[model samples]
Target: MYIDGALTDGQGRIDVINPATEDSVATVAAAGFADVERALAAARDAFPGWAATPIAERQRWMRRLRDEVIANEDDLRACVHHEMGKPWAQTEEDWDRVVASLDFYAEEIARLQDFSLPDRAGTHSHRMVWEPAGVAVAFLAWNFPLLNLAFKLGPAMAAGCPIIIRPSNETPISAYAIGELCAGIGLPRGVVQVLATETYAAADALSASTIPAVLTMIGSTETGKHVIRTGATSIKKYAMELGGNAPVLVFDDADLDLAADVVCGVKFSNAGQICVSPNRVYVQRSVLQAFTDRAVARARAARVGFDRDDDITTGPLINARAFDRIKGLVDRAVAEGATLLAGGDRPQGMNRGHFLAPTVLGDVTETMDVYRDETFGPIVSIIPFDTEDDLLRQANDCGQGGLTAYVFTRDLARAEGYAAALRYGEVQINGVKYDIDLPHGGIGYAGVGHDCSYLALHDYLVLKRITRARDTTLFESVNA
Candidate 1:
C-alpha cells in the first residue's frame, strides 16, 4: 500500500496471478479496517492544504508525475502486461493513457477561470467560482488497470482533491508500482494513496466514510449501486463509468471490410474486456453473410500468445472464473441454435493459460443470453435486421447500459439520423475514436458522469457563486 507519501505494509497480502501463465507474478498489500481508516484520515488531513495549493504548483507536480511515467514507461507496461496477462501491444494503450491523462489534465486545470454572470436587474455583479470538492475515494476496475486509474487520478489531482485509490484485487501490482513512483517524487502525504483490500468489509469502509465528498468508480452497474447505497451516509457526489452493452449497426451499403476490421479490432483487444466494446452487431440482412465472413477471417488470423515478441493479439482472461463464464456463454449460445462461425474453445496447443479463442456467432437473437448480457470476452454475436426501424428498436433496447453505438454507412443523412436517435452517449459513424480530450460517458445504467475532456473536471469541483451589490454612484461615475 502507498499511503502518507510512503510505501507501507498492510495486515495481509494478495498474490497477483498472471492470467497467461496462471502463475503468481507478485504479492501486493491488502488493506484491513485499520489501514482503511488511516488512509481516510490521511486524506481528510491533507485535503485542505492540497486544495489550497496554487494551480501552477499543482500543475508542476502533475507534470513531474507525468515525467516519471514517461521515464519508467517500459517498467509500467511490464507491470500491466504481467499482472493482467494483457498482450504486450495492448499494454501500450494502458501506458499511453496514463501519460496522456496526466499531461492533459495538468494543462486543462490551468484553463479554468472564474466566470462572470450578468445580473438581469443590473443591481449586482456575480461570479461563479470553482473549488475542490474535498476528499475523493476511487474504485478501479481490473481490465485496464492503469488506464482506469489514470481516468480517476488525473482529474482528482488536477482539481486539487486528495484521492485514495482502491484498485481491484484481481490486478493490483500495476497500481502498487504507481504508488512507488509517487513516493519517489515525494508527493504530498495523503494527496494520493493506492491500496487494495481483499475483504469487502475493508473496501466498504472507504465508501461508508463521511470524509469523502466525492465517490467515483469504474466497474459494474451493480457495484456502482452498492457504493452509492453504502456511501449514502452523506450527500456525496458520485461519478461512475459502469457496464456497457454497446451496439454496432452495419448497413447494407456500408464498407464491409472497414466494419469488420473495427468490430474485430475492438472485440479482440484486451480480450474484449472494454466497457465500450461492441456487444451486439446488427448487420443488414442483405449483407449479413458478407460481414460475418470478414469478421471470421479476422478472428481466425488473430494471434493468441504470451510472448512479448510474438506480436500477440488476443490474451488470457483474468482468471479461471472469467474463463469458465465466457466459455459457458459460448456453449449456451451454440446450444440455443446460434451458428458457431469461427473459434469458440481455447486455442490449440495452449493448455495452461486461461486463453479463449476469438469467437464469432451468427444468427443470434435478442432472446439469447449471449445477446442480452454484456459479454466481456473475445466473442462477437451477429444479429441480422431487415429494416432501419427494426434495427433502431433492437439497438436502443439495451437494458444493461448505453455507453456507445457504432454505425457503418456511406449515407450521411442516414448516419446523422441514427446518431441523433441513438440513446447511447457516443455514436461513431464509419470509425471509432476515444482520447483524453473527448467526453466519455453514458446514459441509463451506463454511468452518471464524464471521464474525459474538460467536462470530467466538473466531477471533482464544486460551484460557488459570489455576488456584490453595485453602488449607483460608482456605476454612474464609471459610465461618465
Candidate 2:
C-alpha cells in the first residue's frame, strides 16, 4: 500500500482467496484509519503541484501507461483470470478496451487545452480552461476490475489530478499490477495509489476528508447510495457507474439463430456478473417456442467451469452471497409458477467452488421476483409479450433504469419504434453491439450518470461561462 508518499504495511493483512479453488492467492494489507489518514495527507500535499502540471505532460504519462498496459497484455489477462475467474478471451478483450479508451483520451487531449471563444458581440474574448478538480478517489468493484478503474482514472490522469484507488477484496491483482506499472512509468509522487483490503478504510477515510476533490465509484446501487450519503458532508464532486438489469427483446420476425447466439454471449459472459448483461429476455408469442428451444440448446452447449482450461461460457459466482441471491430468485420465480426451461440445478461436478449452472426460466411473468430483481449471475428469465406496447411496459416497469435494452427485429421501422420506446442508456437494434463512442446509461433506476464518449467527460469537468461587454467605452457611456 502507498501512504503519505511511502509504501507501508497496514496493521493487518487480508488474504485474497480464489473462489474457484478456495485457496489463498495472495495477502494484502488491510489498512486502518491511520493508514487512510496518511494517504489523504499525501493526496492533499500533492494536489497543488499535480493540478498545476501541464495537461500535455499528464497526457504523455497516460500514453506511457497505455503502452505499458498493451505490452504487458498477457500478464493482465492471467491476473484477471485467476483473481476474478473471468474467461481469458474476455480478459484480453477488456485489456483491448482499456487501451482503446487510453487512445481515445490521448487523441482527444486537445479538448482539455485552454481556448478563447470567438468574439461575437464583445471586445474581450471568452476564455475556457479545464482544471483538475484536485484529488480523486476511485472505488472499483470486483467485476471487470481494471476496466472500471480505467473509466475513472483515465480521465482524471488526463485532467492532471492525483488518484487513490481502492480495489475490491475479491479482485485486486490486476489493479495492483496497474499501480506498479504507473509507478514504474514514474507517476508523480502521490499522483496515484492502489490498495487492496477487506475493510474500505482507505475509501471511507477519503470520503470523510477534504483532500478528495472528486470521488468516482463503480459498484452496486446500494453502495452508490451509501457513497452519496457519506460524501454529502464533504460536498465533493462524485460520479458513479452502478448496477443494471438489462433486457433483451426478441420480436416475432427476429432471426432465432442470431438472437440466440448473441444473447447467449451477452447474458452469460462473465458468468452473468456484468452490470450491462441482459438479464431478462422478452420473446414475442409468435416465436416464443422456437426462441426458447434454441436459446436453451445453445445454453446447454455452453461449457461451465474454470476459465483457465475450459473455454467455458460461464464460471463461478463471485461468492456465496451472489450464489444465494441467484438461487433465491430462482426459488421465487418457480414458486410463482414460472417453469424452469433448463439449468435449475447446480452443476453436478463442482462442489467446492461457488459455481452456478447457466439457468434459463420460462413462463416468467412481470409480477414474479425474478423479473423484478437483478440476479447478477448466470441466470436469465424469459417472458412472452403479445404486443409492442405490452413488451415496452414490461421492460420499463422496473424501478432500476440503468438497463441496456436489446431489440431483435428485421423490420427497420419496428426496430426504430422499439428503440425509441425503451428507457435505457443504450439500446441495441437487431442484436448490435455497444460502441465506445456512444453515450451509455439508463433512465429512471438504472443509473444517474453516463459513461463513454464525450458525454462522459462532462461528469468529470465543471464548465465556466464568461460574458463581456462589446465595448468597455460603450458601457461607460451608458452609465454617463
Best by lDDT: 1
Q: After superposition, how far is residue 440 of candidate 1 from its true place, in Å?
A: 0.6
What TM-score does candidate 2 get on C-alpha atoms?
Answer: 0.92
Worst 10 residues of 1 by lDDT: 304-313
After the best TM-score superposition of candidate 1, give how far the Cα of residue 382 lies from its true spot, in angstroms. 0.5
In candidate 2, which residue ranges exceed 4 Å CA deviation?
A: 4-6, 112-124, 466-480
- Tens digit per residue, CA lDDT, model 1, 19-60: 999999898889999999999999999998999999999999
- In candidate 2 the C-alpha lDDT for residue 246 amounts to 77
Assess candidate 1 and give its lDDT. 0.93
Put down candidate 2 lDDT per residue, 1-480, tens digits, no spaces: 765545667876877776766677787776677777777777778888877877677778778989999999999888888887776777876677678777776556557556678886556768786666778887889888777777766666666677888888888788878877877777778787877654665556667676787887887888888877777777688777777777898988898899888788777788888888777899989999999998889778878777566477787788778788888899888998999887876788788877878888999887887887777888778888887766777787667565677889899988898788787877887766664566666665556666667566656666665756667788898899
Judge candidate 1 at residue 290 and give its lDDT.
Answer: 91
- Which residue pairs in model 1 clash with each other? none
Per-residue lDDT of 186 in model 2: 73
Each model's TM-score? 0.97, 0.92
